[model samples]
Target: MALSRQNQSFRIPCQQCPLREITHLRDFTADELEFVSRFKKGELVVEAGSTILVEGAHSAHLFTMLSGWAFRYKTLEDGRRQILNYLMPGDLVGLQGSIMGEMQHSVEALSPVILCVFERERLLTLYNLHPSLAFDITWIAAQEERILDEHLLSIGRRNALERAAYLIAFIFERGRRLELFDERRFIPLTQQHIADTLGLSIVHTNKTLKKLSSKGLLRWQERGCEILDPEGLLEVAGWTGLGEGKRPFV
Candidate 1:
């Protein structure tokens, strides 16, 4: 996924999708758009396992998720990786570094991912030229913080089955928001990744998944997961979107 001159024109398909309509680009002036368009058409946006920003590194650029998923992670001394957070379309990676020059966590693509990036100098110029851009960036940061809090609650208190159910429900709603998914379609994460995130063993994760299927929650397919009973799944997950004790599906 290294960006070379040969495949320069390859852009991520999700960049121009209809789902982007919900994302406001009011801060992008004609000049800003023109500058961004040059990088937009290049393959620099999508990369597999590419480190967008490393922990404790001088942060020079900010990334916007256009397609695929990414994680903010830190490796423990014993070599175990703690999954700090998961990101989706419209989410900004390492915005906290915009003011401070260093990143606290490393950001890597969870899959082949597409991102929109702006260098720190360029972003500062844009902010000075357009106060609206600064406002938008602040708003997006707040939303990201709220999401992290919700994930903390889910991973900390919920049981294995409930965690699985909560994750499924959250993914469904997120996909729907981005116009990238349907209830009949399956999610693409493997059981191993889910196990790691949910703090369960692979065997337990598989058993829990099978139990959900037997209970008529959904059908798990090779490519993704489908919700057979969206209502039932919601109940099992104990979802209360946008509340103080919310289940993190909003």
Candidate 2:
């Protein structure tokens, strides 16, 4: 797990960030942009399989996902793991650690990742001086809660096949919105990731995925999953969709 930290001279400027061009994210004001530029300390790059944040550790910095994929997970003493959720470009990381003083779950890079790093100590300064940005942070937290609520509903009530369908549809929709998928419609995930996320065994996860594939919904690849029929997967999962529109990010 190689980690690289770039000095501020190499950091991407906030005003010129590519993520800001995404239609789903709100545009920042001149003042807000200037503040964010200063707030961002530098950039951190980590390879796939790198642990960016560890459970029970205190980090002096927060991060905004600049590129690539990551996941939040928690593990038991016996080493059983549960994946809480996936992270994409524009997702904020380490907020829980900043506020709570320690991370409750670990974050790992699913793909080589670039992150915009910010000083955690300056969080309160932002809240005090910039009310709207503070509100955006609160909204981000609320959004995470809503996502977890849906995940709980799926794992607690949905059948194995339905759960698998829901997870695939969820990741596909997010990637589509973020323009992460190419012509191949690939998503970076494995059966083990799906099993951990859905709280199922590896064998059961494989069987459930095969059932979805038989229905012409998705295709499992060597190192990832290809979204073949997103609408069909959503229908099978009984999910309405992400319902996202011009979301905020700090």
Compared with the true structure, what per-residue lDDT tens digits does model 2 show for residues 37-144?
999999999889889999999999999999999999999999999999999998999999999999999999999999999999999999999999999999999999
Candidate models: Cα lDDT each: 0.66, 0.92
Task: Report the lDDT of model 1 for residue 97.
Answer: 78
Say which candidate scores most in TM-score.
2
| TM-scores, all models, native as reference | 0.77, 0.98
lDDT of 1 by residue, 1-250 (tens): 2431223456544335333365332324455445455424333455656676777888666667767877778777796666666777667776777778788877777677766655666776656765655666776677778777877888898887888898877766666555566445566666766776777788998999999999999888764567787668788989854323211110
20 in model 1: Cα distance from truth in Å? 3.5
Candidate 1 runs further than 4 Å off: 1-19, 22-43, 47-51, 242-250
Q: How far is each candidate from the true structure, as Cα RMSD in Å?
A: 4.9, 1.1
Task: Tell how far residue 218 is off in model 1, in angstroms.
Answer: 2.6
Error of 2 at 38 (Å): 0.5
